[model samples]
Target chain A: MVSTYVTSSLILRILLVYLMVSRIAFAHDANEASAYTVQEIAEGNFVHEGNFPPQSLENRGDIANIGFIVGEKCVAVIDVGSSLHVGSMLKAAIQRVTRLPICAVIITHVHPDHLLGLNAFTKDDSITVYGHHRLPKQIRTRSRFYLESLEQYLGAGNTADHAIDPSLVTPVNGLLSIDLGNRVIELKSWDYAHTDHDLSVTDIKTGTFWAGDIVFSEHVPILDSNIRQYNAVLEELQKLDVQHYVVGHGSLDRPWDVLISEQRRYFRVLLREVRAAIVNDISLMDAVNTVGWTERDRWHNFDMYHRRNVTTSYTDLEWED
Target chain B: MNFVKRILTFIGASLLFCQLALATPFPEPDHSSIPEWIMIKQLMFGEREIRDGSDDILALYLNTKLDDSSTVPIMVNALMDQTEDKYIKTLYLVIDRNPIPTAGVFKFKPEAGRVKLETRLRFEKFSFIRAIVETNTGDLYMDQRWVQVAGGCSAPSGKNANDPSLGKMRFRMDDQIRLNEPNLVQFQIKHPNESTLASDLEPGYAARFIDKVAVEFNGKSIMSGDINFSLSDNPIFKFYFSPQAEGVLSVRAEDTHDTIFTDSVEIGTDKR
Candidate 1:
């Protein structure tokens, strides 16, 4: 009778330990699920709005908007976040919403903020990655530097097991349409704009447009490519009939046309002043400091990126005949 | 068998330790005593004394708060006018942290009334840009500026290699030519000045950059330089030249790929 009593107590202890372990695991998962919260902006479109600050350890490199669109049968992820941790959080957010398998991932550009989290979603065997035709070449050249930077920003431990495989990306030359069961999304490749290789996505059913880095809202628009071409692309984007839209950065509270026009006005002032500087034989060194001071108080992070925009415009406009 | 197993375990543990050591982020070493400068100074000067030139001989001008790493505008001006007895014969522009530290070695003639070089350069990282001028008597004087810029080496040179206007040249100067005085002239060449460290370059392809530049008036050298990809794309050079008479001011530039680009503007006494 004493032996039976001891066995019963032992079994109870084992069950208690199992329950504790399972509960801790469940709590950990719940924390992760809450970490990346998404809002259903439209009927089927979900977006996790990111902060406006630059990538830092505190932000975990989650400075760009990333989300997914669910269809009746499958889902398509617009962009993964800046790092694997952010991407995994996004994946958890998707799981919380629906159980549909992810069919495709559309990359916006070659910038580290948009491209680094790609490894997280590429793990699934059924997922196919899409990007501009020029993206693979850009990746081949830039991945090493981006990886080194990732190690610096997030510690080496967080950066471990992360690798960017450019070959996994299927090239989208001009316009390519993919079907997520009954719903179809169009991926468009653009000429040199924000970056040389920029891709934008549009959902046919919901009329939701993912502008990627092509259309930045509050945060200063970065110019990694030609300024004139960027302005031209902005004009082209103005014509699109976007019902619901997601910008690459900042809040989408304002109408899409207002965002594009603000960005255009910034570039216009930059272009005019820089061209005048060049025409007046003002040195590039002086142009950077004095060219774009008029629009100083208008934009966020203007102090950080406005000079760079001036530099880009000065160099490009100097070649003008 | 037991001994062998212990040895294998020790090897694996050592490997892990080595990786951990590599993974740990350490504070950046003090840049005041830059180790690269030590090596570069030894390689180039070889025990020659370099005096401070900021106060008397030359001045290096660059903004400490650099906006663009790939295209930073810089100017180096000689404090004294060029004369037969005391003239700067050679000017060396060096970025301490660039892959090719010596951006250019320019040779100047005493006929140029004043020496002022205004150009653009690419900085790989936050490092000192040194302008070391060698006088006709072989005296070395240096002026250095600390510039904070990064990632220029690995950033893609955005120019298209197959551009139709690859070797085109342009010249700009005052509408009226000044005679027997220091007249400023600017000339530029169209080349990518591709750096080997540019990340977007294809594998196994040699980086093509302008390696030689010669500026002359009436077949007499005014300013000539041995430059490299450390210069920014579409390299532009603005300097002062004194022409004794009406003559052709010409520029010839050669790239690493052995292609030469040449252009000239006739400086006449009357405004054209």
Candidate 2:
């Protein structure tokens, strides 16, 4: 009788311990799911402001501003974060706001930070991905390097399940409007400006413009494409009468015109100085060191990216007739 | 006591699992010694000793903190001027960790007056950029700068292959030319210099790049280089050429696709 009692009590103890441990694990996941907070900038339009620092393991690759819009029946997700973890958090954030199914995912560009989190939402068969028409080609060429970089940032295990499928993206050539029941979001793809391909979103109901990386506010503007073309695109963007706007990085407190002008001025200076350097018989190596020092204090992270801008400008404009 | 021990072991196991789930920290930049260099050195120079060139022979200049991996401007300057008796006959540009370790092998004529090479390169990873000089007496000296850049070889070439001005060349020089003195001239070719490692490149399509670059003054060779796609797109070179008299500075470049681009600028006596 004593042996039977002891055996029964031991089994009960083991069962209780297992239940407790599993429950704790479940609770931990729940906490992580709700960790990302979103602010409704406009009605039905939510934005999660990301960190200012570059992607790091500590940040879990949440370096870009990402959010989604809820309509009457479904939701449209804008640029997803950099990793699966970030995407899952955004998904959970959406669930916390509404139970609507995500019908569309709009990618702003082919950059890794905005494109890698796509797989997290892709698991659901209902979501149709949208990006620039040129995005698919860029993805095909750059995805391998981006994945390797992700592994470097988030480690092998954290990134093992991450994969970028270019075929999943629906190419947006010029102007495409997506209807989410009562709300409609217009996606416009621009010519080579910030990148070879860049897409911007506009919420028709709210009149809020998601400028993507085309209009950087506080962060130093990165010139990956033609400077003259980029400046011309900015001139066109300035004409849009936006009631509300979200930049790719930095707070959106400044006036839209001021933001556009500041970015335009940076590129203008780069174009002028680089051209002068080429004309004055200055070597490309020497020009990078001295070309863009005047705008150093005007923008953040200028030291890290300005020399590169000079290099690009010198190489491109050197070919000008 | 047995139950307590079991619970402890379970907690310990959970902690271990959690540790595994977390991200691994990034590796520190290690510049102590590169294993790739050991093997590359053996193949390029069989049992040949290399002396440090930073002190007197030549110096390599490059920014250690690279922003763009695809286009990095670098310069190599010879500390001593080129002389007929003891001049740097050949210069080797080597990137230790690239797919092709030898980026270029440039031959310099002593008549050039001085040896200076300025060009842009693509770095595949964090590796050393070495400027190796071989004197006429067969002595080798090397200067290296460690550069931190990645994915340059696979980075998509921004140049459109179907550009209308493809294979065009341009030459720039000072307004005035001096007789019997080293004058700087820069020449650039408009080519993609496409790398095979670029992922989007179609399989079975060979990557096209400049293989031979020859510069001459009045039909006499001054600088000739055997190069590869390690040179950035639209390869530009700046070097010194001594002008004994008025002559045409001509450049003929041949690519892997069997296309030849040639351009020349006349050095006028009016400037002299």
Candidate 3:
């Protein structure tokens, strides 16, 4: 009877310890997720962009994690990253999840925010940076400007990682393809939308298109593009079959119909305004002063962006055919 | 005959409507107030003070007034996103490119104030910019004024960055940091901070991005960092830190290939 009692108590003790430990671990995990409030937009889709915006000394947030998606063999990185440090962190993070080579880097557009980060990919033989043909040239010509921008944004003692070898530039134009063991990604360029060299990537299997700046989910679209070209591009994209997407600036989203409609409406209004200005023979300034922008109050940076859009539209309509 | 008349009327009406809409004039942004972030109260240029309380979070407040041309949301978001911490909060709000998009404020923690900086900004039309102070304890405070022009910061550096290389590093100082006070480090280095927004009148930027920097105090290592591509041209940074000993204050900088450059100053214990 003594032996039986001792054995029973020991078994009970082990069970009790297991339960207590499990509860503590589970609680810690819950706290962690809430602290960062990480919301994974797409499952099976890895993120490569380092913490939406890169690290800032004067930044207002406390969380920092590079975006990643794990693949079968070599993973696909959306934006490689800005500096060598970010690049190093990105590589380590990807390795943590998989042993795949960085198959290809898809630059959504020519903007520094999207493309400059590719310098991080060290294994040149295996990795390829896919962007519009105009991309490599832009990097070559706009390199200095990019450096200045770094100084303005990152401040001193922090730019150590911004060094990039311009000679290592890898440029591509037209359609590009990536075969990731089980998945196939097809990259297609948009004819003059956000930039002269805008490319959109579609994961054939998932039916999700990485829509660069062609679709900004949150803020107003900065106009590096003329209205006619932008409108035409939008119309062209609307005809394609896209179900899910990753926008350049805002959160990745589903339910594309509404977003597309709103973007289209904006362009339509702009075209109409410009068309009116031309007929009335209003000076460019007067025409800019005329858009009854009450609709602007509804959005955050509408006026700042709208004026640029209006200016571009007016100039395009006014200038060459 | 009635069907024919209906078709003709539709065609004529469409043409007339198009003409009327095209006949209107362009709209203009209102210029009324100053934008925020142009001032640093309590913290003067080259001034130092003890940070109150030892809590980790740094709270910074900014205010601004704006009119129609202000790209209010983008600039604000840019500022917020630039910080990356997300803990930075906006205590006040306003934008006047609309019915009343005039003023706003943002509050951030002490830890969030990585480096104090100054830059020319774009404040479409005209308006005041502002932000309030909120400690982790929940005290609220505010600051701001208006900017007169439309686009200033993004209007292009107007300097040709295509000139072969990021320019040579230039340094200036009064020979030493005033004793017991934070040292005034003035640095001007060649960098493009390329937005990739410019085109080459001449073919340039033939290499990868290169914006690397580092700073050390006395003989102790302080901090090293990577400058993002968003920094302005010929970058200028003025920072402060208290020193304990009088030693050679040296600055060493390098680019991607690890090509290093150095400059040093003799920090003496007493001033003449």
* Candidate 2 lDDT tens digits, B1-272: 46556876987776555445443322434432678888888899889999988899999998655788999889999999988898999999999899998999999989989999999999998788889999999999999887878888889887787788888998877788888889888889999998988746666778888999999989999999999988999988989988898989889999998989999989975763
lDDT of 1 by residue, B181-212 (tens): 99999999988898888845556788889999
* Residue-level lDDT tens digits of model 2 in A46-115: 9988876477544667878889989998999999888888888888899889998999999999887787
Model-by-model DockQ, in order: 0.29, 0.43, 0.05
**DockQ measured for candidate 1:** 0.29
Residue-level lDDT of model 3, residues B1-272, one tens digit each, is: 34445755786676555444333322233222222222233222223322322133332222222232222222222122213333333233332321223222323233223322221123423344433323343433333334443432233333345545454555444454565454544454555443333334345533222345555666565434344323334444443434556766566665443456566666675642
- Off-target runs (Cα >4 Å) in candidate 1 are A1-32, A156-160, B1-32, B199-204
Collision count for each candidate, in order:
0, 0, 120
lDDT of each: 0.87, 0.86, 0.51
Candidate 3: residue A18 Cα off by (Å): 37
* Residue pairs in candidate 1 whose N, alpha carbon or C atoms collide under 3 angstroms: none
Evaluated against the true structure, the overall lDDT of model 3 is 0.51
Candidate 3, position B206, lDDT: 36
Query: Cα deviation in Å at residue B118, candidate 3?
Result: 32
DockQ-derived CAPRI band for the predicted complex in model 1: acceptable
Instruction: Let me know the DockQ for model 3.
Output: 0.05
